[model samples]
Target: MTSGIPDSIMALVVKQDGYNPNPEGGIHFETMEPYLEFKEIAVPDLAAGQVLVGMAMAPINPSDLHFLKGEYGQPRRAGKPAGFEGVGTVIAAGEDPYAQSLIGTRVSFAATPDGTGTWATHAVAEAMLCIPQPDSVGDHDAAGFIVNPLTAAAMFEEAKAAGSPGIVLTAGASQVSKFIVALARDSGLDSICIVRRDVHNQVLTDLGATVILNQTEDDFAAELTSTMKERKPRFFIDAVADATSTQVFNAMGKDSTWMIYGSLSPETPPLPNTGELIFRNKVIKGFWLSPWLSGAALDEKLAVFAEVQARFSDGRWSTEVGATVKLDSAVETLVEALADPRGKVFIQP
Candidate 1:
């Protein structure tokens, strides 16, 4: 064990009834106070292949909210800490050689569904799950290593593998979408970015997006159809799933693939028109980073990780941090985080 490691640490615990039934009703910090509590808790012990991390920073992500609301694919136990990915320094390790080697090194890791998470002063994670951060990467960038960046790279690889001349992406101004634009440009592929507002048009255009369509505009459908027909984009990466997805699907060419990775709209998207699905052979599927990484070979995972790190180091890809909060202010911080969708909110635990 490391010399200064504590026996107990502060953590934000999520209760069984953490989720609010009506998200539109807004959070009542008083009544909903029972849902999450900040308190001192005993530090978890390291398992055979685990290492205890002294968490430096963790982000409040959309998935974290979904998990807290009990809407995520993976269920979380009540009374456990909440957080998905973070950057930390390894304080102690189990007897395994790899675990021991990680001791005292700063690394990034995603929380296991086994109760422990990064929203604590310390967390225990499988040693192999942690990736040592290079000195060129700062704590802020490394804290988000596992989610948006990796997903952007992976989705781009999928589009490339499909031999797509171009791709269509929803939520064009999102951090991940920006990464997609940059990566797609680097790979010599074209991208058509769909956003809800004209404010993001120039931002995405500057990012190398070949086509920028504002969904709020009157001619959005016509523009999308015209661009899709001309580009023949074989892949559609969607984040906002609603009627927008159906429109994109109708615009795509035959044999095009629609990959839904996030449900930002909180409503299930309507299925594509019957004729398009039946005769065009359009495909629809979901993409989650956990399953994608798990199914990947070790070399493939390493290559992607290396590419993500290099981009961060070179300043080619990054998410803007809108705010940072302490563990004790989790409730208030979460309220603020929910109100802002423009950038990431971080917890400096």
Candidate 2:
């Protein structure tokens, strides 16, 4: 280890061969015990463009769960720490000037594409991926800096660029959906939010959801069809890629587009509405945050980081903390807490 940095760091890591996938296909208490193991490992050395971050906190996103199952886009590296993003102070830097400049500065960073992750006392990241955090943005919000916020901003931009009169969003109670709903409200674009629980989702109206509908309602299909016809929405941004998503896409008029970003449901949806594709100009596509960020211009990324900080600092966005798991107990406690995931989950390293 260099200078004062410790020779060893405590991390919650996965054992490659020992990783147990829940038969049900998601994280579950019964089958998740071996998914993570708490260990004391040697500190990783920095590469030329990397910096060592002493992690303060990291959020548990759906991507992390998918990662545990080897279902996410990136392959999970066993024996390494397991977190995608976090807020921390850069304690050490590599030979590069940009990395050196970040030393001792507190920032929010995304784990490198193939690096040991942030669920540890110290983590390594490329300097270019780190965003210096403003004092006004608290630790909780900073922990969730990139994934949800950036995706929300990018998807909202997609909706606007599509020239859609309104957009349909599934999983209305989620943080990303709330941010998009608020953005649409400010931009004067109509938004329809769909959720399972009527009582809990009705409050979405406060976040700028022009219409909040319960998918389980008896007359949901008729009501959605009527509203879609009236609104003439041409874009459906979906997280749940199930039969319901297909139903929502079918509700829209001709020339509509369905953009799927996540698959919260285990079932795969089929392209049953081929007539719309053949006759009309309706299309189906996807949106992934990784490529979008990598493909964005430097100025655009910087502007997004600045705007995200401003929004989180000014109360326009709040990443609510539901549970903060200790590094040692994460192997077991995390699965139970995520059963409901009442608010955002965090790991304080």
Candidate 3:
């Protein structure tokens, strides 16, 4: 047994055996929590170069929903705990010197690539991937620090590096998009925020968005094309890949790149437009955090993480937490608690 650690860890695990995500294959949020079983299991043992995180909080993100539906990049085990990222203190560490150094530190962690989930009392993560949490950031902010904020930073940097005049964002109401909107404004670049509803307009506008377009409005197409002409936003940070993304991509002038980071929609983007590919020089690509972080330098990752912490620390950027669902009742209460998408639902012990 390890010091300051218990043998059994209680977690909300998914039973993936019989649940079908339906014939259409989109994640049904309501059915997801019912498939989860909250129970006790032995704490995962750490190997060399790993640390044991006594987790504090984790969020239920769109990615987590996709994973529960067995549609995420990683494979899911039948009884495996369900979560991706969380903040916790290192209660135990394996023999590696770097790992041992993290023994008493609080850190934010993503689940290991080997499919170890983070929704647990304790998680075994590689010491290298456990980012030290700054004292300025609280557990609520830190639990979600990695996923949305880091993606916002990386993708925004990509647009900046390309010298984009403005960035176009689909699903602008999302946490990542909100961060990007504030970033573009602070950088003195235009942020064209696209949303399905006009109700999200004020929140995004308050974040300094250059343009807000409601895809449901009748004038959306004209606004998109006109904005494309004026702002010349060639870089698209897309989260929802559907007909709307197609329309936005079509409106661009030339050398436009559609960077899809999430799949909130089930419809595949009808692509391979011979003209766009052969003539206009448009391209489409995917952004998965694991591969991106894995390929980045240690220094770059640390710099981005630190910068994100500073943003959350200040009032400039923040993720709203509507409620904190206790671990014991997470399975029963998570879905209802998360019904309002405006604020995030956090799970904790």
Candidate number of the best TM-score:
2
Ranking the candidates on TM-score from highest down gives 2, 1, 3
Candidate 3 C-alpha lDDT tens digits along 170-278: 9888889999999999999999989987777888989999999889888988998898999999899998889889889888878988898888888876884668877
Looking at candidate 3, the ten consecutive residues that score lowest on lDDT are: 18-27
Q: Where is the poorest 10-residue window by lDDT in model 1?
A: 23-32
Candidate 2 has its poorest 10 consecutive residues by lDDT at 18-27
Of 1 and 2, the candidate ahead on lDDT is 2
Which candidate model has the greater TM-score, 1 or 2?
2
- Measured with C-alpha atoms, the lDDT of residue 105 in candidate 3 is 96
Instruction: Give the per-residue lDDT digits (tens) of candidate 2, residues 176-211.
Output: 888888889888999898898875465577777888
Predicted structure 1: lDDT:
0.83
The C-alpha stretches of model 3 lying farther than 4 A from their native spots are: 17-26
Candidates sorted by lDDT, best first = 3, 2, 1
Clashing pairs in 2: none
The TM-score values for the models, in the order shown, are 0.93, 0.94, 0.93
